[model samples]
Target: MNKNIVLKAENINKYFRVPTLFHVLKDISFEIEKGEFVSIMGKSGCGKSTLLYILSTMDTDYNGALFLDGEDLSHKSADQLAFIRNQHIGFIFQFHYLLQEFTVLENVMLPAKKLGIKSLEEIEHDAIEKLRLLGIADQAKKLSMRISGGQKQRVAIARALINKPSIIMGDEPTGNLDSKNSEIVFSILKELSEEEKLSLLVVTHDIDFAKKTNRIIEMEDGRIIS
Candidate 1:
């Protein structure tokens, strides 16, 4: 396993046989290094999410060799992949996706709890710290539905980071936000990547935000373009 290259995918292909067969993703290849922020930009329906899903090991019924930290994950079963993903990767989606019924603190602690961290107090303390880092500590006791969208998304980021994953993947993270909120969201993303040495793969349509990453990969027709 290469210490620097956190993820690398070669010749990835995916298809769906629903309402007829659809070849959603063609052969694709890319590599992402540790602490590197890469933006995946493309038009709508261009298979960017398919690629992200594959990289994150969320969608595994595909053809490719996906290496994470120098280990090939293409052969791992769904359950095994889930374990690695919960510990090593975080995901932020366009929707905040925080459980509306749970308090921010509880939501953030969910992943750690699932990982069998027996010390609930310590885990809650850690979740509180992540909320503080995202400047939403005050909302920790509040339900996700009661907060602003931006705040909710911040909570989502905190939840994603609570496990201290080495990599964070965002799928159009700010697509649902207005300009100011989008800036705030991406700024947090940029800062977190630097401070935590996290490998970030953000899929976005915003050119300005996309260009801020260390590398920007443009996609067309399910293929990465230089």
Candidate 2:
């Protein structure tokens, strides 16, 4: 409930019913404060990604209380959750989910367009600024498919920043990149957290990546082990 806390998850638990019921997460409780860069590390199937989804408001079939920017998310309708996600949370995945046919600027503008709080010209200008912030403004006029993998991911990051979400959530954001590209992305994210006062919660298997974050939450068997 602290004003400085950007996200808080309390007594979170999850289960999957297919092929018999299976417990996926257990009593996960944590808080991320403004401008803090945090990483979650664990083996596959340890529920790090699953937890991210729940925290991101993409998955609602779980028992827990999730708070973002002081608003409780439990029991919210799908549409309400969608608006919350669009307005308060930005997400990046292991893969850049850019539309191949769209130009980089268009891709970055999509989320802000959905929010519909700004005019077209304003959105375009904001998108360009985000691209410039990521050092990819020159690529904005090109189709997403024409860019390199690293460039595409930077476009994704730009897209995620378009709305100035209170927190950015990434699930193995650098998983598909080479070391050079990965380091570039990491530095970009780190700078955003420190300089822009943006909160970041990243789920990564890369030990080196986890080590560089402000804090690391290690998971085992669906529980935070450290």
Candidate 3:
């Protein structure tokens, strides 16, 4: 494995037993390098989202060897995988999963707080800094329910970044936003990959969004088509 590679999946295959076996993913093999912004594009049920889930360590029943940041994750225990996920991978879903009752700063600090590697005060400071970097510092004191849709998404990004994970994985991160806000979110992600040297892997249906990424891995019928 190259030292510059941030994630690598070798010979990945997945099957679901609905009644009989249904193949969900073919033998997928790929590598994402550090500071790279990559997109996975495919129609619904094409296995793009399934692939993302497997790479994120959320689905381990599939046959594959998964590596992140030079660590092989083939047989790690659930607790070990959880720690690796918190410390090495940040995830953003289509919907902003912020706790509506929690203030923005508190939402962002949740991951770091759970990791328990830093003091509450230190995590609070770092969370604020992440929100500031995402240009939502003014909303830090507001409850999540009080913010706008785009603001909430940015807050999710802030939460993802609080731990400074080696890679950020987003599944339709901008799917729920309008075009204007979608562009804003895309630009911010691009900037983070380029300027901050973060590795990003996004699963998006928006063709325009896919075009903006460094590379696109297109899948069809559970196989890489391009």
Candidate 4:
């Protein structure tokens, strides 16, 4: 494993047994380097999201190897994988998934609190700092539901950054936003990769968005075609 490789998947395969044992992924192998920004582009049901889930260590019912930061994670226990995810992987999705009842600051702090490695005060400070970085610090005290959709997505990005994970994975993060908001989010992600040296792997159907990334992994019938 290269020291600079933040994530690697070798000969990975997945199957769905409930629906007559359909193969969802086949020989999916790829590597994402530290500070690299990559995007996965594919048609619907091409298993791009499934591959991302496996890489993120959220789906372990697959064959082959998954390595994160040079550590093989193929056989870790569920609890162990959970801990690893909290500490090493950050995720964003098409929807923000913010808890409407919680304040923006609290929403951003939840993952750090779950890790239980920092004092509440320290976690709060870090959460605020992340919010500030996303330019949503002023919304910290407001309820998550009070913010607009664009702000909500920014809040989700802040929450993802609070843990400072080795890699950030997004599943159509800009899919739910308007063009302006989508561009705003994309610029933020690009800046994070350039300035913060963060590793980002995003799955998107938007070809324009995919074109802006460092590399684009195209998939068809569960295999990387290019």
lDDT of candidates 1 onward, in order: 0.89, 0.95, 0.95, 0.95
Clash count of each predicted structure: 1, 0, 0, 0
Candidate 2 weakest lDDT stretch, 10 residues: 84-93
Instruction: Give per-model TM-scores.
Output: 0.95, 0.98, 0.99, 0.99
| Candidate 3 lDDT, 1-226, residue by residue in tens | 7999999999999999989999999999999999999999988999999999999998889998999988899999999999999999999999999999999999999999999999999999999999999999999999999999999999999999999999999999999999999999999999999999999999999999999899999999999998
Error of 3 at 16 (Å): 0.4
Q: What is the C-alpha lDDT profile of model 4 across 114-150, one tens digit per residue?
A: 9999999999999999988999899999999999999
Model 2 agreement with the true structure over 182-208: per-residue lDDT tens digits: 999999999999999999999999999
TM-score of 1: 0.95
Residue 13 error, candidate 3, Å: 0.6
Error in Å for residue 121 of model 2: 0.7
Stretches off by above 4 angstroms in model 2 are none
Off by over 4 Å in 1: 19-21
The TM-score, computed over Cα atoms with residue i paired to residue i, of candidate 2 is: 0.98
Better of 1 and 4 by TM-score: 4
User: In candidate 4, which residue ranges exceed 4 Å CA deviation?
Assistant: none
